[model samples]
Target: MIELREHERKTLLIVERLDGKASVEQVINESGLSDAAVMRAALTLQEKKLVKMKEKKQTIAKLNKEGKLYAERQLPERRILDVLYKMGGEALLSNIPKEVDISSNAVSVALGWLVKKNWAVINQKKGTIALVESLLTQKPKKGADEKLLELLAEKDTVVIEELDKNPQQAVATLKRRKLVETKEKSTYELELTKKGWKLVKKGLEVAEEVTLLTPELIITKKWRETKLRKFDVTASGPAVYPGKVHPLQQIIQRAREIFLEMGFTEIRGPLVETAFWNFDALFQPQDHPAREMMDTFYLA
Candidate 1:
Protein backbone atom coordinates (compact mmCIF):
# COMPACT_ATOMS: atom_id res chain seq x y z
CA MET A 1 0.00 0.00 0.00
CA ILE A 2 2.74 2.43 -0.90
CA GLU A 3 1.55 5.85 -2.06
CA LEU A 4 2.72 7.00 -5.49
CA ARG A 5 4.96 10.01 -6.00
CA GLU A 6 3.65 13.26 -7.52
CA HIS A 7 5.53 12.83 -10.79
CA GLU A 8 4.32 9.24 -10.98
CA ARG A 9 0.75 10.46 -10.49
CA LYS A 10 1.23 12.90 -13.40
CA THR A 11 2.34 10.06 -15.68
CA LEU A 12 -0.61 7.94 -14.57
CA LEU A 13 -3.05 10.77 -15.36
CA ILE A 14 -1.61 11.05 -18.88
CA VAL A 15 -2.18 7.34 -19.51
CA GLU A 16 -5.76 7.64 -18.23
CA ARG A 17 -6.49 10.62 -20.53
CA LEU A 18 -5.26 8.58 -23.46
CA ASP A 19 -8.53 6.63 -23.03
CA GLY A 20 -6.84 3.32 -22.14
CA LYS A 21 -5.39 3.30 -25.65
CA ALA A 22 -2.03 5.08 -25.70
CA SER A 23 1.40 3.93 -26.75
CA VAL A 24 4.37 4.90 -24.54
CA GLU A 25 5.20 7.62 -27.07
CA GLN A 26 1.74 9.17 -26.67
CA VAL A 27 2.02 9.00 -22.87
CA ILE A 28 5.44 10.67 -22.90
CA ASN A 29 4.24 13.41 -25.24
CA GLU A 30 1.10 14.22 -23.25
CA SER A 31 2.82 13.94 -19.87
CA GLY A 32 5.86 15.96 -21.00
CA LEU A 33 8.03 13.07 -19.87
CA SER A 34 11.24 11.83 -21.39
CA ASP A 35 11.13 8.39 -23.07
CA ALA A 36 13.28 6.82 -20.37
CA ALA A 37 11.38 8.45 -17.52
CA VAL A 38 7.95 7.46 -18.88
CA MET A 39 9.02 3.85 -19.37
CA ARG A 40 10.40 3.67 -15.84
CA ALA A 41 7.19 5.03 -14.26
CA ALA A 42 5.01 2.73 -16.41
CA LEU A 43 6.97 -0.32 -15.26
CA THR A 44 6.75 0.84 -11.64
CA LEU A 45 2.96 1.27 -11.84
CA GLN A 46 2.49 -2.17 -13.45
CA GLU A 47 4.66 -3.86 -10.84
CA LYS A 48 2.68 -2.10 -8.11
CA LYS A 49 -0.64 -3.28 -9.69
CA LEU A 50 -1.93 0.30 -9.82
CA VAL A 51 -1.74 -0.06 -13.57
CA LYS A 52 -2.60 -3.13 -15.67
CA MET A 53 -1.68 -3.87 -19.25
CA LYS A 54 -4.55 -4.15 -21.75
CA GLU A 55 -2.56 -5.06 -24.86
CA LYS A 56 1.18 -5.15 -25.53
CA LYS A 57 0.84 -1.62 -26.93
CA GLN A 58 -1.25 0.04 -24.16
CA THR A 59 -1.07 0.53 -20.38
CA ILE A 60 -3.75 1.92 -18.02
CA ALA A 61 -3.66 2.90 -14.35
CA LYS A 62 -6.82 2.06 -12.43
CA LEU A 63 -8.40 3.35 -9.22
CA ASN A 64 -11.12 1.73 -7.15
CA LYS A 65 -13.99 3.60 -5.41
CA GLU A 66 -11.72 4.20 -2.44
CA GLY A 67 -9.11 5.84 -4.61
CA LYS A 68 -11.61 8.16 -6.29
CA LEU A 69 -13.04 9.23 -2.93
CA TYR A 70 -9.57 9.88 -1.54
CA ALA A 71 -8.53 12.02 -4.53
CA GLU A 72 -11.83 13.87 -4.50
CA ARG A 73 -11.44 14.85 -0.85
CA GLN A 74 -7.96 16.14 -1.57
CA LEU A 75 -9.30 18.57 -4.14
CA PRO A 76 -9.73 22.14 -2.92
CA GLU A 77 -13.44 22.45 -3.59
CA ARG A 78 -14.32 19.14 -1.91
CA ARG A 79 -11.94 19.30 1.05
CA ILE A 80 -13.27 19.83 4.62
CA LEU A 81 -12.30 19.21 8.22
CA ASP A 82 -13.61 19.41 11.81
CA VAL A 83 -12.24 19.81 15.34
CA LEU A 84 -13.71 16.76 17.03
CA TYR A 85 -12.13 17.17 20.45
CA LYS A 86 -14.93 15.32 22.23
CA MET A 87 -16.21 12.52 20.05
CA GLY A 88 -13.50 9.86 19.93
CA GLY A 89 -15.13 6.99 18.01
CA GLU A 90 -18.41 8.36 16.58
CA ALA A 91 -20.19 11.62 15.74
CA LEU A 92 -23.30 12.92 14.01
CA LEU A 93 -23.88 14.48 10.60
CA SER A 94 -26.43 16.94 12.12
CA ASN A 95 -23.53 18.41 14.13
CA ILE A 96 -21.80 19.05 10.78
CA PRO A 97 -24.43 21.53 9.56
CA LYS A 98 -23.08 24.41 11.65
CA GLU A 99 -19.40 23.34 11.74
CA VAL A 100 -18.84 22.89 7.97
CA ASP A 101 -19.27 25.43 5.18
CA ILE A 102 -20.40 23.21 2.32
CA SER A 103 -23.66 22.23 0.67
CA SER A 104 -25.65 19.40 2.31
CA ASN A 105 -25.14 17.21 -0.76
CA ALA A 106 -21.34 17.19 -0.20
CA VAL A 107 -21.69 16.53 3.56
CA SER A 108 -24.03 13.57 3.08
CA VAL A 109 -21.84 12.00 0.40
CA ALA A 110 -18.68 12.32 2.50
CA LEU A 111 -20.22 11.08 5.75
CA GLY A 112 -21.52 7.78 4.30
CA TRP A 113 -24.65 8.24 6.47
CA LEU A 114 -27.29 7.83 3.79
CA VAL A 115 -28.89 4.51 2.83
CA LYS A 116 -31.27 4.86 -0.09
CA LYS A 117 -30.75 8.59 0.32
CA ASN A 118 -32.09 8.37 3.89
CA TRP A 119 -30.10 9.15 6.99
CA ALA A 120 -29.41 5.90 8.89
CA VAL A 121 -30.12 7.38 12.33
CA ILE A 122 -31.55 10.50 13.89
CA ASN A 123 -31.73 10.97 17.65
CA GLN A 124 -32.68 13.73 20.01
CA LYS A 125 -31.52 13.89 23.66
CA LYS A 126 -32.78 16.89 25.66
CA GLY A 127 -32.36 19.87 23.27
CA THR A 128 -29.33 18.39 21.51
CA ILE A 129 -29.78 16.52 18.20
CA ALA A 130 -27.50 13.96 16.52
CA LEU A 131 -27.48 11.80 13.40
CA VAL A 132 -25.33 8.69 13.20
CA GLU A 133 -24.19 6.28 10.52
CA SER A 134 -21.23 4.01 9.92
CA LEU A 135 -18.74 6.49 8.50
CA LEU A 136 -16.17 3.72 7.91
CA THR A 137 -18.69 1.62 5.99
CA GLN A 138 -18.80 1.56 2.20
CA LYS A 139 -21.35 3.76 0.50
CA PRO A 140 -23.75 1.65 -1.54
CA LYS A 141 -22.60 1.80 -5.16
CA LYS A 142 -25.15 0.76 -7.77
CA GLY A 143 -23.75 -2.31 -9.54
CA ALA A 144 -20.24 -0.87 -9.53
CA ASP A 145 -18.59 -3.92 -7.97
CA GLU A 146 -20.67 -6.41 -9.94
CA LYS A 147 -19.62 -4.71 -13.13
CA LEU A 148 -15.96 -4.96 -12.10
CA LEU A 149 -16.25 -8.66 -11.24
CA GLU A 150 -18.05 -9.47 -14.51
CA LEU A 151 -15.35 -7.66 -16.50
CA LEU A 152 -12.48 -9.27 -14.57
CA ALA A 153 -13.95 -12.76 -14.88
CA GLU A 154 -14.40 -12.37 -18.64
CA LYS A 155 -10.80 -11.35 -19.44
CA ASP A 156 -7.44 -12.55 -18.23
CA THR A 157 -5.93 -9.10 -18.65
CA VAL A 158 -8.01 -5.98 -17.96
CA VAL A 159 -7.56 -2.43 -19.33
CA ILE A 160 -9.48 -0.91 -16.35
CA GLU A 161 -11.01 1.59 -18.73
CA GLU A 162 -14.61 0.43 -18.25
CA LEU A 163 -14.23 0.45 -14.47
CA ASP A 164 -16.65 2.75 -12.61
CA LYS A 165 -13.78 3.84 -10.37
CA ASN A 166 -11.20 6.53 -11.09
CA PRO A 167 -8.82 4.49 -13.24
CA GLN A 168 -5.94 6.97 -13.11
CA GLN A 169 -4.41 6.86 -9.65
CA ALA A 170 -2.05 4.56 -7.76
CA VAL A 171 -3.69 4.37 -4.35
CA ALA A 172 -2.08 3.43 -1.07
CA THR A 173 -5.51 2.30 0.16
CA LEU A 174 -6.33 -0.39 -2.43
CA LYS A 175 -2.84 -1.69 -3.20
CA ARG A 176 -3.03 -5.49 -3.33
CA ARG A 177 -1.97 -6.83 0.05
CA LYS A 178 -1.23 -10.30 -1.28
CA LEU A 179 -0.71 -10.80 -4.97
CA VAL A 180 -2.33 -13.70 -6.83
CA GLU A 181 0.06 -16.61 -7.42
CA THR A 182 -0.11 -19.42 -9.97
CA LYS A 183 -0.75 -23.04 -9.02
CA GLU A 184 0.51 -24.13 -12.46
CA LYS A 185 3.81 -25.82 -13.27
CA SER A 186 5.08 -23.52 -16.03
CA THR A 187 3.64 -20.10 -15.14
CA TYR A 188 2.40 -18.00 -12.18
CA GLU A 189 -0.31 -15.35 -12.00
CA LEU A 190 -1.84 -12.97 -9.47
CA GLU A 191 -3.72 -15.01 -6.85
CA LEU A 192 -6.48 -13.37 -4.90
CA THR A 193 -5.75 -12.60 -1.26
CA LYS A 194 -8.09 -13.89 1.46
CA LYS A 195 -9.23 -10.32 1.94
CA GLY A 196 -9.58 -9.81 -1.82
CA TRP A 197 -11.71 -12.91 -2.46
CA LYS A 198 -14.06 -12.16 0.43
CA LEU A 199 -14.56 -8.62 -0.87
CA VAL A 200 -15.24 -9.67 -4.47
CA LYS A 201 -17.31 -12.83 -3.91
CA LYS A 202 -19.31 -12.16 -0.74
CA GLY A 203 -21.57 -9.16 -0.27
CA LEU A 204 -19.35 -7.91 2.53
CA GLU A 205 -17.36 -4.68 2.59
CA VAL A 206 -14.58 -3.75 4.96
CA ALA A 207 -13.87 -0.31 6.36
CA GLU A 208 -12.59 2.52 4.24
CA GLU A 209 -8.79 2.79 3.89
CA VAL A 210 -8.38 6.50 4.44
CA THR A 211 -4.95 7.62 5.65
CA LEU A 212 -4.83 10.55 8.04
CA LEU A 213 -1.77 12.73 7.80
CA THR A 214 -0.40 13.88 11.15
CA PRO A 215 -0.08 17.59 11.91
CA GLU A 216 3.67 17.19 12.43
CA LEU A 217 4.05 15.34 9.15
CA ILE A 218 2.24 18.13 7.32
CA ILE A 219 4.88 20.60 8.60
CA THR A 220 7.65 18.56 6.99
CA LYS A 221 9.63 20.38 4.27
CA LYS A 222 8.40 18.11 1.48
CA TRP A 223 5.20 16.69 2.96
CA ARG A 224 3.90 15.78 -0.49
CA GLU A 225 6.49 12.99 -0.42
CA THR A 226 4.20 11.37 2.13
CA LYS A 227 1.23 11.73 -0.30
CA LEU A 228 -0.20 14.67 1.68
CA ARG A 229 -1.13 17.71 -0.36
CA LYS A 230 -1.31 21.18 1.20
CA PHE A 231 -3.86 23.43 -0.45
CA ASP A 232 -4.61 27.11 -0.11
CA VAL A 233 -7.71 27.32 -2.28
CA THR A 234 -8.03 30.77 -0.78
CA ALA A 235 -4.63 31.81 -2.13
CA SER A 236 -4.96 34.64 -4.61
CA GLY A 237 -3.03 35.10 -7.85
CA PRO A 238 -3.26 34.12 -11.46
CA ALA A 239 -2.29 30.60 -12.56
CA VAL A 240 1.37 29.87 -12.21
CA TYR A 241 3.90 28.33 -14.62
CA PRO A 242 5.88 27.00 -11.56
CA GLY A 243 9.17 27.45 -13.40
CA LYS A 244 11.16 30.00 -15.38
CA VAL A 245 9.92 32.13 -18.26
CA HIS A 246 9.05 30.84 -21.74
CA PRO A 247 11.76 29.72 -24.21
CA LEU A 248 10.12 31.59 -27.08
CA GLN A 249 10.49 34.86 -25.16
CA GLN A 250 14.10 33.98 -24.46
CA ILE A 251 14.72 33.39 -28.17
CA ILE A 252 13.05 36.70 -29.02
CA GLN A 253 15.28 38.53 -26.49
CA ARG A 254 18.36 36.89 -28.09
CA ALA A 255 17.18 38.02 -31.51
CA ARG A 256 16.73 41.54 -30.14
CA GLU A 257 20.31 41.50 -28.85
CA ILE A 258 21.60 40.11 -32.18
CA PHE A 259 19.88 42.92 -34.12
CA LEU A 260 21.38 45.59 -31.80
CA GLU A 261 24.85 44.09 -32.24
CA MET A 262 24.49 44.33 -36.02
CA GLY A 263 24.12 48.18 -35.76
CA PHE A 264 20.50 47.98 -37.00
CA THR A 265 17.58 49.44 -35.09
CA GLU A 266 14.76 46.94 -34.90
CA ILE A 267 11.34 47.83 -36.27
CA ARG A 268 8.09 45.82 -36.03
CA GLY A 269 5.18 45.56 -38.43
CA PRO A 270 2.17 43.25 -38.77
CA LEU A 271 2.47 40.18 -40.98
CA VAL A 272 -0.92 41.07 -42.55
CA GLU A 273 -1.97 44.63 -41.75
CA THR A 274 -4.76 46.96 -42.92
CA ALA A 275 -5.00 47.86 -46.64
CA PHE A 276 -4.36 51.50 -45.63
CA TRP A 277 -0.70 50.48 -45.39
CA ASN A 278 -0.59 47.14 -47.24
CA PHE A 279 -2.23 48.42 -50.41
CA ASP A 280 -2.96 52.17 -50.17
CA ALA A 281 0.66 53.11 -49.36
CA LEU A 282 1.82 50.51 -51.91
CA PHE A 283 -0.61 52.04 -54.52
CA GLN A 284 -3.32 49.32 -54.80
CA PRO A 285 -7.15 49.11 -54.69
CA GLN A 286 -9.06 50.08 -51.48
CA ASP A 287 -11.53 47.17 -51.64
CA HIS A 288 -9.01 44.68 -50.14
CA PRO A 289 -9.87 42.09 -47.47
CA ALA A 290 -7.02 43.56 -45.38
CA ARG A 291 -9.22 46.62 -44.82
CA GLU A 292 -11.96 44.50 -43.20
CA MET A 293 -12.06 44.17 -39.42
CA MET A 294 -12.35 40.37 -39.73
CA ASP A 295 -8.84 40.35 -41.10
CA THR A 296 -7.64 43.56 -39.50
CA PHE A 297 -8.40 45.77 -36.47
CA TYR A 298 -9.99 48.94 -37.89
CA LEU A 299 -9.44 52.41 -36.33
CA ALA A 300 -13.14 53.25 -36.42
Candidate 2:
Protein backbone atom coordinates (compact mmCIF):
# COMPACT_ATOMS: atom_id res chain seq x y z
CA MET A 1 0.00 0.00 0.00
CA ILE A 2 1.22 3.48 -0.88
CA GLU A 3 0.37 6.47 1.29
CA LEU A 4 0.75 9.78 -0.49
CA ARG A 5 0.45 13.42 0.52
CA GLU A 6 -2.61 15.27 -0.85
CA HIS A 7 -0.69 17.30 -3.45
CA GLU A 8 1.43 14.34 -4.59
CA ARG A 9 -1.65 12.12 -4.90
CA LYS A 10 -3.52 14.82 -6.87
CA THR A 11 -0.60 15.28 -9.28
CA LEU A 12 -0.23 11.54 -9.85
CA LEU A 13 -3.98 11.14 -10.51
CA ILE A 14 -3.91 14.02 -13.02
CA VAL A 15 -0.93 12.46 -14.83
CA GLU A 16 -2.80 9.12 -14.93
CA ARG A 17 -5.93 10.78 -16.33
CA LEU A 18 -3.77 12.56 -18.93
CA ASP A 19 -2.95 9.05 -20.34
CA GLY A 20 0.26 8.70 -18.28
CA LYS A 21 1.88 11.75 -19.91
CA ALA A 22 1.28 15.47 -19.36
CA SER A 23 3.24 18.69 -19.32
CA VAL A 24 3.78 20.53 -16.02
CA GLU A 25 1.56 23.36 -17.31
CA GLN A 26 -1.33 20.98 -18.03
CA VAL A 27 -1.11 19.46 -14.56
CA ILE A 28 -0.87 22.95 -13.01
CA ASN A 29 -4.10 24.03 -14.74
CA GLU A 30 -6.03 20.85 -13.95
CA SER A 31 -4.74 20.42 -10.37
CA GLY A 32 -5.37 24.11 -9.50
CA LEU A 33 -2.02 24.25 -7.70
CA SER A 34 0.84 26.73 -7.89
CA ASP A 35 3.63 25.80 -10.31
CA ALA A 36 6.12 25.53 -7.44
CA ALA A 37 3.83 23.25 -5.46
CA VAL A 38 3.10 21.08 -8.48
CA MET A 39 6.80 20.83 -9.32
CA ARG A 40 7.70 19.91 -5.74
CA ALA A 41 5.07 17.14 -5.69
CA ALA A 42 6.18 15.88 -9.10
CA LEU A 43 9.79 15.69 -7.90
CA THR A 44 8.71 13.76 -4.82
CA LEU A 45 6.77 11.32 -7.05
CA GLN A 46 9.84 10.88 -9.24
CA GLU A 47 11.92 10.10 -6.16
CA LYS A 48 9.35 7.47 -5.12
CA LYS A 49 9.73 5.80 -8.56
CA LEU A 50 6.13 6.65 -9.44
CA VAL A 51 6.86 8.99 -12.36
CA LYS A 52 9.60 10.02 -14.78
CA MET A 53 10.14 13.67 -15.65
CA LYS A 54 11.63 14.92 -18.89
CA GLU A 55 12.72 18.47 -19.67
CA LYS A 56 12.56 20.18 -23.06
CA LYS A 57 14.47 23.35 -23.91
CA GLN A 58 12.49 26.08 -25.67
CA THR A 59 13.82 29.37 -27.03
CA ILE A 60 11.38 32.24 -26.67
CA ALA A 61 12.00 35.52 -28.49
CA LYS A 62 10.54 38.94 -27.71
CA LEU A 63 11.19 42.58 -28.55
CA ASN A 64 13.03 44.71 -26.00
CA LYS A 65 12.69 48.50 -25.52
CA GLU A 66 14.75 49.42 -28.59
CA GLY A 67 13.07 46.82 -30.75
CA LYS A 68 9.62 48.09 -29.82
CA LEU A 69 10.66 51.68 -30.52
CA TYR A 70 12.15 50.75 -33.92
CA ALA A 71 9.05 48.70 -34.79
CA GLU A 72 6.86 51.77 -34.40
CA ARG A 73 9.23 54.46 -35.80
CA GLN A 74 11.20 52.27 -38.25
CA LEU A 75 14.90 51.28 -37.94
CA PRO A 76 17.62 53.94 -37.91
CA GLU A 77 19.19 52.51 -41.07
CA ARG A 78 15.88 52.39 -42.94
CA ARG A 79 15.12 55.97 -41.92
CA ILE A 80 18.56 57.10 -43.20
CA LEU A 81 18.04 55.19 -46.46
CA ASP A 82 14.75 57.06 -47.02
CA VAL A 83 16.54 60.38 -46.41
CA LEU A 84 19.34 59.38 -48.83
CA TYR A 85 16.83 58.49 -51.53
CA LYS A 86 15.15 61.91 -51.17
CA MET A 87 18.58 63.61 -51.39
CA GLY A 88 19.12 62.40 -55.00
CA GLY A 89 20.47 59.03 -53.80
CA GLU A 90 23.48 60.61 -52.03
CA ALA A 91 24.34 63.10 -49.29
CA LEU A 92 27.32 64.27 -47.23
CA LEU A 93 27.70 62.36 -43.94
CA SER A 94 27.20 65.57 -41.95
CA ASN A 95 24.19 66.57 -44.07
CA ILE A 96 22.29 63.38 -43.09
CA PRO A 97 21.01 64.89 -39.79
CA LYS A 98 19.62 67.93 -41.66
CA GLU A 99 17.75 65.66 -44.10
CA VAL A 100 16.42 63.13 -41.56
CA ASP A 101 14.62 63.40 -38.21
CA ILE A 102 17.21 61.07 -36.60
CA SER A 103 19.27 62.25 -33.62
CA SER A 104 22.85 63.45 -34.07
CA ASN A 105 24.14 60.60 -31.86
CA ALA A 106 22.32 57.95 -33.93
CA VAL A 107 23.71 59.23 -37.28
CA SER A 108 26.94 57.23 -36.98
CA VAL A 109 24.99 54.16 -35.84
CA ALA A 110 22.66 54.44 -38.83
CA LEU A 111 25.61 54.97 -41.19
CA GLY A 112 27.26 51.74 -39.96
CA TRP A 113 24.05 49.74 -40.50
CA LEU A 114 23.51 51.24 -43.95
CA VAL A 115 26.97 50.05 -45.05
CA LYS A 116 26.48 46.63 -43.38
CA LYS A 117 23.13 45.98 -45.11
CA ASN A 118 24.63 47.03 -48.50
CA TRP A 119 21.84 49.60 -48.89
CA ALA A 120 24.38 52.41 -48.98
CA VAL A 121 28.15 52.97 -49.19
CA ILE A 122 30.34 55.40 -47.23
CA ASN A 123 33.11 57.37 -48.98
CA GLN A 124 35.31 58.03 -45.91
CA LYS A 125 37.74 60.28 -47.82
CA LYS A 126 34.89 62.35 -49.33
CA GLY A 127 32.86 62.30 -46.05
CA THR A 128 29.73 61.39 -48.02
CA ILE A 129 27.12 58.59 -48.17
CA ALA A 130 25.72 57.23 -51.45
CA LEU A 131 23.07 54.62 -52.12
CA VAL A 132 24.14 51.42 -53.98
CA GLU A 133 23.84 51.83 -57.78
CA SER A 134 21.35 48.96 -57.85
CA LEU A 135 19.13 50.74 -55.27
CA LEU A 136 19.19 54.01 -57.26
CA THR A 137 16.96 52.54 -59.99
CA GLN A 138 14.44 50.97 -57.59
CA LYS A 139 13.15 51.57 -54.05
CA PRO A 140 14.79 49.28 -51.49
CA LYS A 141 12.53 46.63 -49.97
CA LYS A 142 12.39 45.73 -46.25
CA GLY A 143 15.20 43.52 -44.93
CA ALA A 144 14.92 40.50 -42.62
CA ASP A 145 15.47 42.63 -39.47
CA GLU A 146 12.58 44.93 -40.45
CA LYS A 147 10.25 42.01 -41.16
CA LEU A 148 11.11 40.25 -37.89
CA LEU A 149 10.58 43.47 -35.89
CA GLU A 150 7.12 43.91 -37.46
CA LEU A 151 6.20 40.32 -36.66
CA LEU A 152 7.33 40.64 -33.03
CA ALA A 153 5.48 43.93 -32.72
CA GLU A 154 2.25 42.29 -33.86
CA LYS A 155 2.58 39.04 -31.86
CA ASP A 156 4.60 40.40 -28.88
CA THR A 157 6.55 37.09 -28.65
CA VAL A 158 7.47 34.20 -30.91
CA VAL A 159 8.86 30.72 -30.33
CA ILE A 160 12.08 30.38 -32.31
CA GLU A 161 11.16 26.87 -33.36
CA GLU A 162 8.07 28.11 -35.27
CA LEU A 163 9.77 30.86 -37.28
CA ASP A 164 10.52 30.59 -41.01
CA LYS A 165 14.14 30.64 -42.28
CA ASN A 166 14.54 34.37 -43.04
CA PRO A 167 13.00 35.64 -39.79
CA GLN A 168 14.80 32.93 -37.81
CA GLN A 169 18.16 34.04 -39.23
CA ALA A 170 17.35 37.66 -38.37
CA VAL A 171 17.00 36.75 -34.67
CA ALA A 172 20.78 36.54 -34.21
CA THR A 173 21.45 39.99 -35.71
CA LEU A 174 18.58 41.56 -33.80
CA LYS A 175 19.93 40.04 -30.57
CA ARG A 176 23.38 41.54 -31.20
CA ARG A 177 21.85 44.96 -31.89
CA LYS A 178 20.01 44.76 -28.54
CA LEU A 179 16.68 45.11 -30.36
CA VAL A 180 15.43 41.65 -29.37
CA GLU A 181 16.05 39.30 -26.44
CA THR A 182 15.75 35.53 -26.36
CA LYS A 183 15.42 33.33 -23.31
CA GLU A 184 16.03 29.59 -23.06
CA LYS A 185 13.45 28.00 -20.76
CA SER A 186 12.86 24.45 -19.66
CA THR A 187 9.42 22.81 -19.87
CA TYR A 188 8.78 19.58 -18.03
CA GLU A 189 6.63 16.60 -18.98
CA LEU A 190 5.74 13.74 -16.67
CA GLU A 191 5.05 10.13 -17.58
CA LEU A 192 4.03 7.26 -15.34
CA THR A 193 6.67 4.57 -14.67
CA LYS A 194 5.91 0.82 -14.70
CA LYS A 195 5.97 0.82 -10.90
CA GLY A 196 3.60 3.80 -10.94
CA TRP A 197 1.13 1.83 -13.08
CA LYS A 198 1.32 -1.13 -10.75
CA LEU A 199 0.69 1.10 -7.72
CA VAL A 200 -2.28 2.73 -9.46
CA LYS A 201 -3.75 -0.71 -10.21
CA LYS A 202 -3.43 -1.76 -6.55
CA GLY A 203 -4.92 1.59 -5.44
CA LEU A 204 -3.41 4.21 -3.07
CA GLU A 205 -4.53 6.31 -0.10
CA VAL A 206 -4.24 10.10 0.32
CA ALA A 207 -3.24 10.97 3.90
CA GLU A 208 -2.89 14.31 5.65
CA GLU A 209 0.51 14.15 7.33
CA VAL A 210 1.97 16.85 9.60
CA THR A 211 5.38 18.06 8.55
CA LEU A 212 5.46 20.87 11.13
CA LEU A 213 4.33 21.16 14.75
CA THR A 214 2.83 24.50 15.69
CA PRO A 215 1.86 26.06 19.05
CA GLU A 216 -1.84 25.84 18.20
CA LEU A 217 -1.66 22.12 17.47
CA ILE A 218 0.20 21.50 20.76
CA ILE A 219 -2.23 23.70 22.71
CA THR A 220 -5.28 21.99 21.24
CA LYS A 221 -3.74 18.50 21.79
CA LYS A 222 -4.54 17.77 18.07
CA TRP A 223 -0.95 16.57 17.47
CA ARG A 224 -1.83 13.32 19.25
CA GLU A 225 -4.36 12.36 16.52
CA THR A 226 -2.25 13.41 13.48
CA LYS A 227 0.49 11.42 11.82
CA LEU A 228 3.88 13.13 11.91
CA ARG A 229 5.60 12.82 8.52
CA LYS A 230 8.96 11.08 8.56
CA PHE A 231 11.89 13.30 7.77
CA ASP A 232 15.40 12.55 6.40
CA VAL A 233 17.73 14.74 8.42
CA THR A 234 20.62 13.86 6.11
CA ALA A 235 18.87 15.57 3.18
CA SER A 236 20.16 19.03 2.38
CA GLY A 237 18.00 22.05 3.17
CA PRO A 238 17.58 25.26 1.22
CA ALA A 239 20.62 27.54 1.21
CA VAL A 240 20.50 30.53 3.57
CA TYR A 241 22.56 33.72 3.34
CA PRO A 242 22.26 35.90 6.41
CA GLY A 243 22.83 39.57 5.80
CA LYS A 244 25.78 41.33 7.45
CA VAL A 245 27.44 44.71 7.34
CA HIS A 246 29.49 45.46 4.24
CA PRO A 247 33.27 45.05 4.62
CA LEU A 248 34.04 48.75 4.13
CA GLN A 249 31.27 49.76 6.54
CA GLN A 250 32.54 47.22 9.07
CA ILE A 251 36.05 48.68 8.88
CA ILE A 252 34.74 52.20 9.30
CA GLN A 253 32.59 51.13 12.23
CA ARG A 254 35.57 49.45 13.96
CA ALA A 255 37.66 52.55 13.44
CA ARG A 256 34.91 54.71 14.96
CA GLU A 257 34.63 52.35 17.94
CA ILE A 258 38.37 52.49 18.56
CA PHE A 259 38.34 56.30 18.47
CA LEU A 260 35.34 56.39 20.81
CA GLU A 261 37.14 54.08 23.29
CA MET A 262 40.10 56.47 23.20
CA GLY A 263 37.82 59.32 24.39
CA PHE A 264 37.25 60.86 20.95
CA THR A 265 33.79 62.27 20.24
CA GLU A 266 32.04 61.27 17.00
CA ILE A 267 30.49 64.10 15.03
CA ARG A 268 28.72 64.45 11.67
CA GLY A 269 29.88 67.09 9.16
CA PRO A 270 28.46 68.66 6.07
CA LEU A 271 28.62 66.35 3.03
CA VAL A 272 29.24 69.26 0.66
CA GLU A 273 32.03 71.69 1.43
CA THR A 274 33.09 74.79 -0.48
CA ALA A 275 36.43 74.69 -2.34
CA PHE A 276 37.61 77.57 -0.08
CA TRP A 277 37.38 75.32 2.97
CA ASN A 278 38.22 72.09 1.20
CA PHE A 279 41.34 73.20 -0.68
CA ASP A 280 42.31 76.80 0.19
CA ALA A 281 41.93 76.25 3.94
CA LEU A 282 44.09 73.16 3.63
CA PHE A 283 46.80 75.37 2.00
CA GLN A 284 46.39 73.60 -1.30
CA PRO A 285 47.39 75.97 -4.13
CA GLN A 286 45.18 76.47 -7.20
CA ASP A 287 47.82 74.64 -9.31
CA HIS A 288 48.17 71.87 -6.75
CA PRO A 289 47.88 68.35 -8.17
CA ALA A 290 45.53 67.39 -5.29
CA ARG A 291 43.11 70.08 -6.51
CA GLU A 292 43.00 68.52 -9.96
CA MET A 293 39.68 67.10 -11.13
CA MET A 294 41.11 63.58 -11.33
CA ASP A 295 42.52 63.64 -7.81
CA THR A 296 39.56 65.25 -6.04
CA PHE A 297 35.81 64.62 -6.01
CA TYR A 298 33.74 67.68 -6.94
CA LEU A 299 30.04 68.40 -6.61
CA ALA A 300 28.20 68.93 -9.86
Top lDDT model: 2
What tens-digit string does per-residue lDDT give for candidate 1 at 22-89? Answer: 56666776767687777676666667665654433223334445444433343111232222223432
Stretches > 4 Å off in candidate 1: 53-300
TM-scores of the models, in the given order?
Answer: 0.20, 0.61
lDDT of 1: 0.46
Tens-digit lDDT string for candidate 2 (1-300): 566788898898889989999999999999899999999999999999999999998899999998999999999989888888888998999888887787887888889989988899999899899999999989778988899999999999998988889888999989988999999989999999999988877876666789899999999999999888877799999998899789999999999999999999987769888899888988988899988889889988
Worst 10 residues of 2 by lDDT: 199-208
- Superposed by TM-score, candidate 1 places the C-alpha of residue 226 at a distance from the truth, in angstroms, of 9.6
lDDT (0-100) at residue 140 of candidate 2? Answer: 79
Off by over 4 Å in 2: 17-19, 57-60, 124-127, 158-168, 182-184, 198-300
